[model samples]
Target: MAQQGPTAPVPVPKAGSTPPVSKPVREGIDLVVNDKLYRHTGDKTMPLLWYLRDELRLTGAKYGCDQGDCGFCTVLVEGKAVASCTTKMEKLAGKRVTTVEGLADGQGKLHPVQQAWIDEDATMCGYCQPGQLMAAVDLLSRQKNPSDADIDKIGNLCRCGSYGRIRKAIKRAAATMKDAKA
Candidate 1:
């Protein structure tokens, strides 16, 4: 038998070599994202975290544990705290979604909760502070007089063990908000 030369393998197309040909499926999701009215097209199953972080570029919500054990994905939805990582965007249709960006004032000033965090030097790694501030704001909005237990129940975690500082900032922010209302 004659010796056969080694044949080269055929090249495979790259995973994303071609632009997506399919039309982007459109579904209407009317919600207020970051204080702006938005109409988004995404599957009802799409997680709220992707809508906020990827679509809107609101990167404040950290990915942490997607299972909701870690409070890093916390955000305010309809003035209540929620775990955005596990929340479905479709469920939030016609609702208000408030991320860290929405907490700022018209002049681009930080919310009292965020300002207090900075003043108290609350964050260490800072990965978890966004959620912490969001949760604190939600708590304060409901319970203007949150006790230690009320604050503790919100489950804001800082791996840096800045819980003490966080509590103090929340108290200061509550007082400030109250004073402003007065």
Candidate 2:
């Protein structure tokens, strides 16, 4: 009897058949995302918002509108506030990116801004509090005494119409920060 050869596996297309296009290999880069070292395996175009929320599990920055119109995804890059939803992870190389998680002290005590929000009962639904607190931290870091107009210009919004309380919280935080400095 003749020796039988092994049969080759058949390649079959599904109901809708389309040839796969060959995509170029993406250049991998090391990112110190949210103060922790990480090697991102995705394309350079991957936004920092998804990386923080999805990959690193840092969910403080909410994804409200994928577009930059909403400030829910705000985060600190090199101590300056930037929207993480549109910020690319590749741009954060060697820079200290601070999220709401980094706002607290090593003992896990809430930052003054965070405590002020609690004290003033600022957060309603609390979806936007992280971004609000981050923006407030940036504002107070630059100007210890930010005017009402300055607070308004920072672009912190609350859908629950907690604007009054938010303003009060910011003011209280500023006072608290000033007293601490004194």
TM-score of each: 0.83, 0.81
- For model 1, residues 10-129, the per-residue Cα lDDT tens digits are 233344574343776345676776666666655677788877777777899999888887889899999999999889977887687889888998797889999989889888999999
Error of 1 at 118 (Å): 1.2
**Top-TM-score candidate index:** 1
CA displacement after TM-score superposition, residue 80 of candidate 2 (Å): 0.8
Which residue pairs show backbone clashes in model 2? none
Worst 10 residues of 2 by lDDT: 4-13
> Residue-wise lDDT of candidate 2 within 1-182, one digit each (tens)?
56323222123334376435387633555554444545565657878888777767789999988887678999998888889999987787646678998788868799999999999999899899899999999998899888889999998678998988988999999999999989
Count of backbone clashes, every candidate in sequence: 0, 0
Cα RMSDs, all models: 12.7, 14.0
